[model samples]
Target: MPSIHKNIFTIAVVAFLFRLLMFFFVFEHSERTIRPDTPSYVRPAINMTEGHGFSGNEHPPFFPSAIRTPIYPVFIAFFYTVFERDVLIIAFVQIFIDTLTAVLIYIWGRRLFSESAARLGGLIYSLSVEQAVHAVFILTESLFTLFFLWAIIAVSCYREHCRLRWLVSGGILIGIAILIRPIALFFPLIGLLFIWMASPNMRWQFMRHGIIFLLIIAGIVVPWVIRNYLTLGLLKVSSISSYNLLFYNAASLSTDLHRISQAQARAAINDQVTKELTALGWKGDELHSAQLYTAWSRKILFSAPIRYVYIHLKNDINCFLPDVTDFLELIGATQGGKETLSVLNQHGLIAAVNHYFDDNIWLLWAVFPFIALLGVTYLGTILGISIQILQKHWDSLRLLFLPAAYLTLLPGAAATPRFRVPAMPYICLLAGIGIAKSIQCYKIRQQQRTPI
Candidate 1:
């Protein structure tokens, strides 16, 4: 095998083994593996297999799902249909997908940076606690991430080769990714902008390519929009965006305005929105419900636009920070997820940290190293981006930094470490370059200091 192939294979093996161990560790904690959103995906999969189409009958209203797109539930249905409805099989599949993503990260780094950087990028992603943690959960992150990487890789290939086929492939991959997670619906625009910025002289030619790229993405996404309109009477891709805007973003602002807990804010908003919707004679009407939420959230969001922006930016920062609680919870070190969130809402972030560590002191010690590793990784990413900026590596800047920046912002006030999973590969790629550059700098300094 070539050295690059051998190195990537090793990284993939390590990633697979690590995630396999995590699956075994957390599979027993059905709550942790299934999660709150797991049923939303799984039930639809079960329904699909039972010939009920994409409708979810979990709550007896038998509503067609407008919040979740079809890709992930369909992914789950495949496993349930072919292998019996064992969630373990689904988790195992996610583990394999995540491992493949790590390999792709290596390939991406090699295409964008150096071989050493590629190897380091693969290793970094393989050892990522967040990536591995999400793999064990029956969430869209793993599969979505796989498609997300493929999309960007295709775009990068298009940039290098100026091929229309690569643009079409990128559009298809990104469209599938959007179905898996609607957060990426605008990513095609980002890709188009990158292609334009990457090729300054051939602007007109690339413009044509960009249009074709976007048309293909629209071709993929518009059908879903049509389906949503026909079934749910909502003229959008998914209602999840509107739901997040109201429940998470606006509720967060409500917490600050009302001086109450997040749960209380959600309750308050729910009551107020419910009464308003009822008065409008749109109760249980999915389309108007979404429109009402957008209006309510916009009212609150615009009332304190600056405050909301601050909150959104703060959430973006949190997206980069290490969140070991999920890992701890999985291994039974922490008591439960709610306790920590409750403490945070009741007291503050510091109090929550103290509460978590005061009880799990030994586990804190165990988790410290991984936290440090994450810190180092972020530092390296910063340094690497700085290097790219100073060197005027626009392609590297666009490919590595733009998506991370976009994903970081797109989650808005809903940002969490979980939301950060899709950007892990890009972060690792930049970190690899940064770490490699730092080592080279150190070696040069060492030679300069030695006697000639």
Candidate 2:
């Protein structure tokens, strides 16, 4: 078989089989452990599809809510309108999207590095167990990852080709992604900074693309912001993130005290939260209450500056850990989380060299190697990005948008598996490059040692 054909076939088979396992078997856990966010999304989707409104009126007397954004629920409604809202069907759709993500990663790697690196990166992404597991959830990660990857690709294209179209498209996509999850609310600003910092020689080119990109982004987001303002008197797209701060700081406070349950602490805050919000002129609305809770969290945090430092340090490290369980809860794991852990244990190719090796009990099993690989690739991407920035490697600096996104989320509350998945494709690209470079070095030394 031809090399291109061979590579394509491998990618196809690997993507199909791995994701098929997730969609068919592994995803049973998702249905079994239905997450709280699932019903929230489903209720809004049903309302939209049935001509009610974007109001999350799961119950009869449901009113308009500015809490959840409409993009993801609207997407679900689109599918429900055509056929039905089956979890299995959603799994299949996500599997397909995830496969295409692998192909995009391959193309991105080819453009950024060598063709060999591209293939390796694509393969690594296809076989990434964490991502496969993530697809099982009826959440925002799969769709968010898709658009995020595409936007990065488009932005990278504009950098290479100097086309305003790619920049505009990237901006529009960012707008779409924000509608699903507000994580990218600040991404346009980050992107603009990246553009200006990217190429000192191409100031005119950067200015043209940057302005167009920002304008289109503003066009996409301003309407939602306006709607939020008019309806809730708040100039925000969604108020859901206020809870992240609330919960994170609440958990941090619990840990500092060392005897209270985070859950109990959170529950206990309700009466005090109501009091605080009422004092602050809050009219007992969900969004306003969340604002108060967030403020209350901040109050707690600032009051104990030393403890705040310790909590933030811990949160940052935990947020980046491999095969983490905090994310498992977001996906609604239940006991399958332990099963997932047991399944992830395994030794590496270095261990394989010792063919007679037995007693795997001494080795780190299941998810350890996957976690180790993730750590290495992520750290490599960080190192590679630092080099790119210092050397003014303009074309590649845009890739920093993803890890930056993850980093912003890190200091907030908790780290989960899904949080890390978005950054994996680019990290894999760098890892593949590192692996290829190592192989090249080893081969060169072997040639030098040849006795001619």
Candidate that would win on TM-score: 1
lDDT of 1 at 407: 85
Candidates' TM-scores? 0.95, 0.83
Pairs in clash, predicted candidate 2: 344-366, 344-367, 345-365, 345-366, 345-367, 346-365, 346-366
Write one digit per residue (lDDT tens) for candidate 1, span 125-183. Answer: 99999999999888999999899989999999988998899989999999999999999
Question: By lDDT, who's the top model here?
Answer: 1
Q: Write the per-residue lDDT of candidate 2 for residues 1-452, one digit (tens) a residue.
A: 98766777788679768877766554555563245577777788898877777777676655666677778888788888887767666767878888888888887777787788788778888887777767666777778877887887888788778778888889989888888777777777777876676668998779877988988988988898888777677677887767766665655565456555455556666667766777878754766876676777777777777876665655554345555343334334322222221122123334432321234323335446666767666765565566566767555655744544554355444554556677677767766766666677789999999999
lDDT of 2 at 317: 46
State how far residue 330 of model 2 sits from its true place (Å): 12
Off by over 4 Å in 2: 1-5, 26-30, 250-254, 257-261, 274-284, 304-310, 324-369, 372-398, 401-411
As a whole number from 0 to 100, the lDDT of residue 216 in candidate 2 is 91
lDDT of each: 0.86, 0.68
| Span of 10 residues, lowest total lDDT, candidate 2 | 337-346
